[model samples]
Every structure is written in structure tokens, then in C-alpha cells.
Target: MTKVWEASVRATHSFLSETSIQKIKISLPKILQQIPDLIIVEDEKIIAFMGISHQELEMLFVAPEFRGLGLGKQLINYAIKNFDVNKLTVNEQNPQAIGFYEYLGFETYRRTETDDAGNPYPILYMKRKEN
Candidate 1:
């Protein structure tokens, strides 16, 4: 999880300080504990994973090497169809992620200056468009 974060989310998040990164690392265990459902794809080791609650996608991370192989999309599709999730938040700094979600038919409906934990990172609240 940490590795994937570094390669995907962290790499593009140039605004994050080392302190902020450390904070995320420290909080991961607690975050995982709070998630109700987690799905993982692995070959030799974990290549990707998605965490969810009743109707929200909590997390989705695909290892850098496995990206562009549609793992994230597959996980999201599974979440929407199986878990009934239709909304999620993404860091506004991650344009690639924003584009990916947009391609998946999600649209940003809200924006905030800080994240759910009050971090300085901006957040974009998105919901799937009804088709």
C-alpha cells in the first residue's frame, strides 16, 4: 500500500511535505481497520486493491508496475456494480486520477480546500453520472 502510494499518489502530489507523507503512513493501519470491505488483486504479491464501505469507495491503489492494465477501472466497476458505491473523493492535484475518474463517467460536484482529515491538500468530491 505504501509503495503504491509513493509511486502513484505521492509522486504526483508535489505539494505534500515529507511530514504529511509520514502522517499518512502512520495513519494507514487505522484507516484499514475502519474499512468494511477490501478487494485485492495479486499475482505473486498484491498488485492492486480497493477498500469500500456501504456506499463509498474508501481507497483504490494499483501498484505502479500494474497500472495501465485497467486494474483501477476494474475495481471501480466492481465497486459500483457489486457494492453499490457511486461516489468518491480524489485529490485535486492528481490530474491523471481526475481524468481517469472522468473517463469512468464520474463528475466533480464539489471542491474543498482541505481533505477529510483537515490536510492542506485540496479535494474533489465526485459522483457517477446516471446512465
Candidate 2:
């Protein structure tokens, strides 16, 4: 799972410096341990995973090789159906992620100048549309 997370982040989070990536990598294990719902898709090895808590999608990552295969959508849809996941935060620099979430009916509700760690990277807070 750690390898998959690193690969996915390297592939998509171009805005993160190597130093920033390493810093996050150090704390990932703790973060993973804290999440209550860890949904994973595995085929021999873990291909993708998402964390859900209190109806919020805390994290989602697909192995770089498995992206664009609708796995992310499938996972989020499953979360919505079963776990009631609705809100999430995405890096503002990651337009691809923002677009993907928007395509799934999430709309930006707020913005933050820095990420949770107080980095310069901005974040977009989003919520799935109520229907």
C-alpha cells in the first residue's frame, strides 16, 4: 500500500517537491493506521485504495499503472452507496483530480491557501452534490 501510494502520488502530484513527498511519506503509515474505513482493490497486489470516515473521503489513490481504468470512480461510487462518502479535499494544483471529482458531481465549497501541513500548496474542499 505504501508503494502504491508513492507511485500514485509521483504520477499525479507534480506540484510536490521531492522533499515534500518524502516528508509526507514518513507520516503515511500513521495516517493509514488512523483511517477507519480502508477500501482497497487488490489483484495479487493492491491496485487502489480509499479511506472514508464520517461520510468524508479522506484519501484515494490508484497505482499509477491502474489509473484511467475507472477504478477511482468505482471506488468512490461504492463509497457513496455503502459508506455515505460525500466530502473530500484535493490539491488545487492537481487540476486532473479536481476535474475528476467534479465529473463525479462534487463541487468546490471552499479553498485553503495552504495544505493541512501548512505547505504553500493550496487545497480545494469539495462536497458531492445533494440530489
Candidate 3:
């Protein structure tokens, strides 16, 4: 079970390598120790969870049968309300996620480029300003 999550996170990091996902993964233990607001979506057969760090929200995943049901938004909103920070980074190439964040009132603050093992990718730094 833990192996599955590690693999999912690794695959997610591979897909969003521009966000320095590997660094985030490496630092996850510290992050979890500091901010342990994990939100889970569960059913009879499966469960999905989102793990958050101080400055980043990550692992927003849903089971195949549970996609497009506003669960992601629910999890993200819960995090925003519970965590002290308001910043998150996303791979610029993931249009759906970009749109999702935008829909939740997170705006792009800056753009970053990453060189991960000779691969280059774009990332967006997004923030929800405090009121």
C-alpha cells in the first residue's frame, strides 16, 4: 500500500518534473512532520489522498471511477482553509490542473524552468493571496 503511493508519487513527479518534484519527494518526511493535513477520498473499493507540505500541495489523485466529481476541488479547498501557506507549483504543461487551480482562485506568480537529469520542463508558481 505504501509502495503504491510511492510509485504514484514518483510517476506524478516524473510527469511534473519541472516543479522540482524529486526535491519535494525527498523532503516529504520533514514536510509531513510539519504539516500533516492529508485529505482522503474513500469508497468501498478504493481511496485517494492528497498530501500537503508547507508551501506546496501535492498528490491530488482520484481513482479512475471517481474522476470529474469535484472531489479534487473539495480536497484542495480543505487544504487552503487548513494550511497556513497559499503557494503551490504545477507543471505548466498540465492544462487540466492549471485550469483547476485557476478555477479555485490561485493565480500564477512566476514561471520557472527546471533541468532534471537533462530534461527541461516549465513550471508555474501559483499563489492564493491572503485577504
Candidate 4:
């Protein structure tokens, strides 16, 4: 969603180009359909959602007004607790997200390419090992 970017620090970063934003918006709904397990966070006036697939995670979004309140961590931890496998991909250039994933004990497993709109984007594969 463009609105999500409008409220996110990542939006201001060079990695969030029009192409990337458009690709994310277009792909999110389809991804959600395939991964119906969703966790949502609601504050006074803001709501965010994160979707969990078989072993993958995606579509993590917090409303602009509700950023920086540890909602992301809560949502992610919820997924970790509920799912057997924990994996996510962050764009290579999105350092903030990469660092956040690392803080949550996700380690980079590989660098890969995603076919988004017939173009390739670099993504870092991160996984949290099971205990």
C-alpha cells in the first residue's frame, strides 16, 4: 500500500522506488490469499497486519501513526510462537528490516533473486532455527 510507505521510514529510503512499492502492493493481496493466518495489532487508531505462510512470513505492515511502538516485534513473535517454521525475505537494501530480523535471531541463509513483475530484485533469506 502506498499509504503504508507514506508513513514508513523505509519509504524515504532509496530502496523503496515506485517499482518496488507497486510490486509489493500488487503481490500482497495474492500472498495473503495463499497465507490466511494473519496476526493484527490495533492501537487507539491504527491497525497493522502480518501474514504467515507454511514456513514463510510476509505482508507485515503497521500503520504510519503506530510505528515504533514494538508492534512489529509483537506480531513477529506471535508468528514465531504459532508456526513451526520461521522464514522471511528482506530486500537486500532494506537495512532497517534486516537489522530487525537479526535482532529477532534470524540469520541470513542466502541471497536470492525474486521475479517481481518480470524483473529481479535481490532478497536476503533469513531463518530462525527451531529449538
Candidate 5:
């Protein structure tokens, strides 16, 4: 799972410094342990994962090899259907993620100049628009 997360981050989170990535890598296991609902896709090893809490999709990661294979969409749709996940935050620098979520009916409702850990990366708070 950690491998999946690291690989996904490395592939998508290009704005992150190696130092920040290292910090996140060190903390990801504990963070995953804390998510109230953790979902995984596996084939011998984990191929993708999601962390949900309080109706929010806290994290989603797909291995590079598994990307473009709809694994991310499947996991996110599962989270929305099963866990009532309607909210999530994405790094503003990650335009691909923004477009992905927007395609799934999410809209940005707020923005912050710094991430939760006080990092310089901008954050966008998004929610699934109610039908």
C-alpha cells in the first residue's frame, strides 16, 4: 500500500520536494492506519488504495502502471457509493487531479495557499455537487 502511495505520488506530485516526499513517506503508514475507511485494490500486491473519513475522501493513489486503467475511477466511485464520500482536497498544483475530480462532478468550494501541514503547496477543497 505504501509502495502504491509512493509510486503514485512520485508520478503525479511533481511539485513536492524530495524532502517533503520523504516526510510523507515516513508518515503514510500511520496515516493509513488512522483512516476510518481504507479501501484497496490488489492483485498479489496493492495496485491502488483510498482513505476515507467522515464522508471525505482523504486520499487516493494508483500505481503508475495501473493508471489510465480506470482503477482510480473505480475506487472513487466505490467510495462515493459505499462510504458517502463527497468531499476531498487536492493540491492546486496537480491539474490532472483537479480535472479528474471535476469530471466526476466535484467542484472547488474553497482554496488555501498552504497545505494542511503548512507546506507551500496550494490546496483546493472540493465537494461533489448535489444533484
Candidate 6:
């Protein structure tokens, strides 16, 4: 989690300052309370994880060293098949993530100026396009 978050979230999510990251680290227990379901990918060590609440994909992160290995797409595929997941939000600043989801047939349908946390970062709301 630390490796993936530092590589992905800390790198792309500008709204999260070092202070905010520290705060988030301390608040994991509280955050876990809201997440009813989670998906994890592990080998010798934990490679990635995702948190979902119903059809909404709340979180996903792949470790830096483990990215580009199709782990993320595989996880999303599992979510789609098992959980009927079709919607998720991404930070507008993370073009790589946007492209990945777009490659998987997700299309942005809404935009928000602030995230659910009321942060100033823009969020792109996306849903899978029907085949």
C-alpha cells in the first residue's frame, strides 16, 4: 500500500500534500470503516488492491514495480464480472489512469470541481460504455 500510494497517489494527486498524506496514513482505520468490500492482488508480496462500495470503485492502486504487468486491468475485469462494476472516479490530472480506463471502455460522463472530500482537485466521473 505504501509503495503504490507513494508512486501513484502522491505523484499524481497534487491536492494531497505531505501533511495530508500523513493524515491519511493515520486515518486508515476510519477509512476502512466505509469500505465494505476490497480486492487485492498478491504474489510474494502485496502487489495491488482495490476498494469498492457496491458498483462504485472507490480506490485502486498498483505498486510501482508491479505496474505495466496487466494487474490493474485484470483486477478491473474481475470487478466487472463479479461485482457489476461500471462506474468509478479518477483525478483529471492523472492522464495515464484516464487512458487506462478509456482503454477498458470507460467514458467520462461527469466532472466535479471538488472531490467528495471537498478538495479542490477535479474529479472525472466515468462509466463503462455499453457494448
> Which candidate number maximizes lDDT?
2
Candidate 6's C-alpha runs over 4 A off are none
**Model 1: CA > 4 A from native:** none
Stretches off by above 4 angstroms in model 4 are 9-13, 23-27, 44-46, 114-118, 129-131
In candidate 5, what are the lDDT values of residues 1-131, reduced to their tens digit? 88888899999999999999999999988888899888888999989888999999999999999899898898899999999899999999999999999999999999999998898999999999999
Name the lDDT of candidate 2.
Answer: 0.95
After the best TM-score superposition of candidate 2, give how far the Cα of residue 89 lies from its true spot, in angstroms.
0.4
Instruction: State, as a TM-score between 0 and 1, how close model 3 is to the true structure.
Output: 0.66
The Cα RMSD in angstroms, rounded to one decimal, for candidate 2 relative to the true structure is 0.7
Better of 4 and 6 by TM-score: 6
Residue pair clashes in candidate 3 = none
Model 5 has an lDDT value of 0.93
lDDT of 3 by residue, 1-131 (tens): 23334554554444655455556567666755664666666675335677788757855666534557887788888887787547887778667778888888889999878632344667788898655
Model 2, position 57: C-alpha lDDT score:
96
Q: Could you give candidate 4's per-residue lDDT for residues 5-67 as a string of tens digits?
A: 345635434666776666666765676677667775655543677777786886577775676
lDDT of 6 by residue, 1-131 (tens): 55665666765666678987787777766776688988877787777899898898888989877779899999999999999999999988788899999999999999999877887778999999998
Tens digits of lDDT, candidate 1, 76-117:
999999999999998998888899999999999999999988
Candidate 1 clashes: the total is: 0
lDDT of 2 by residue, 1-131 (tens): 89999999999999999998999999999999999999989999999999999999999999999999999999999999999888999999999999999999999999999988899999999998988
* Model 6 alpha-carbon miss at residue 125, Å: 0.4
Computed on alpha carbons, the lDDT of every model, listed in order, comes to 0.85, 0.95, 0.67, 0.71, 0.93, 0.84
Model 6 lDDT, residue 56, Cα = 82
Report how far residue 66 has shifted in candidate 3, in Å: 1.2
lDDT of 6 at 12: 60
* Clash count per candidate: 0, 0, 0, 0, 0, 0
What are the TM-scores, per candidate, against the unseen true structure? 0.92, 0.98, 0.66, 0.77, 0.97, 0.89
The stretch of ten residues in a row with the least summed lDDT in candidate 1 is: 2-11
Better of 2 and 6 by lDDT: 2
Model 2 regions lying over 4 Å from their true place: none
